[model samples]
Target chain A: GQQVQQSPASLVLQEGENAELQCNFSSTATQLQWFYQSPGGSLVSLLSNPSGTKHTGRLTSTTVTKERRSSLHISSSQTTDSGTYLCAPFNVGDNSKLIWGLGTSLVVNP
Target chain B: EAAVTQSPRNKVTVTGGNVTLSCRQTNSHNYMYWYRQDTGHGLRLIHYSYGAGNLQIGDVPDGYKATRTTQEDFFLLLELASPSQTSLYFCASSGTGVEQYFGPGTRLTVL
Candidate 1:
């Protein structure tokens, strides 16, 4: 079974500050994806990075597949960015086996 | 827009009761999955299907059954529920990619 562990189970940040979250997975996979759960509890996929670094807006995802590690960086955070960030190692080759991390909760203070 | 929708956003049942959670994905994705989220457990997969009529067991499948009757419809069933089963359930859909979209989620409470 694959195990995914996220660092800094919870965090608090000042608005406009930068935040970093880490995710480590136990097994190799085709891609490492990130999901965000809002304070209102809606879950949405944020990014899917297989390797190297990818950025979307103020968020960036870096994945080292060989190292089984991925990181998410949120720059210039805002109050609306407060939420839980989750990671999962997914294997498209295998149907029914995506391992999810416990997630890192982020709170952006005003 | 592509979306995944779940029925009975909240459910309350008693021990030994029968319950069904329904999911429908308009994304037309081939893969649909069921997961339960708890305080410490994070998210545990209950079952998943690659397509219509195809079912696969996941990490936590005990006391749960799932069916995929159509490409857009997937269902999770609990013939006899327990208090331990009280948790937030999520339904997700994805195509051949690793990226998945989740539903609004269902909160089930068994007394």
Candidate 2:
């Protein structure tokens, strides 16, 4: 089974500090997406960077298909950014299913 | 905004009881998915459908059955719920390979 692994199960950062979350997959992915889940809330799509680099506002996602890995970079994080960042990979081998990572619980403190 | 709505945000069922969770999407997306979230398992896909009347088993499909009778509706069925089925369930929809818009989620507890 192709697994999506997220680094640093949990992270605590001061407000305005930068945060970096890593995601690695075991198989080649045709689609990759980053999702943010607030405390006891539903998941929200943060960015969809299947390949290459993409930036939206203060969040940037870089996916290197050759390496089968991706990273989510948050610049000048805010308290509202305190949530769980999830990585999901689609199209694992013959199966076209999304494999999700456990997620990185990030806390941006003031 | 893409709207994905789930009914009965919270549910409590006794062990061996039957349970059903409903989901509706107005975005007219072709793909719909059902997943469970737990402390250990972040999110495990239980089932998905490409369109109305089409069902596909996901990685964690055991003990669960799903039905997609209409393009706007998808349902998850638990014939004999167990304690292990207690978790937060999420419904999502997407078009092509883009990002999936998820519902508020349903917290189900099988006591």
Q: Which candidate wins on DockQ?
A: 1
lDDT of 2 at A65: 95
The parts of candidate 1 lying over 4 Å away from their true place are A92-96
Clashing pairs in 2: none
- How far is A71's C-alpha from truth in model 1 (Å)? 0.8
Cα RMSDs, all models: 1.1, 1.1
**Candidate 2 chain B least-lDDT 10 residues:** B92-101
Per-residue lDDT tens digits for candidate 1, residues B1-111, read 779999999999999999999999999899999999998999898999999999999889999999999999999999999999999999999886468889999999999
| TM-score against truth, every candidate | 0.97, 0.97
lDDT for position A42 in model 1: 90
Docking quality band of candidate 2, CAPRI definitions: medium
Per-prediction DockQ comes to 0.75, 0.74
Please, what is the whole-model Cα lDDT of each candidate in the order they appear? Answer: 0.92, 0.92
Alpha-carbon deviation at B93 in model 2, angstroms: 0.6
| lDDT tens per residue, model 1, A1-110 | 67899999999999999999999988888888899999888999998898999999999999998999999999999999999999988875555467889999999999
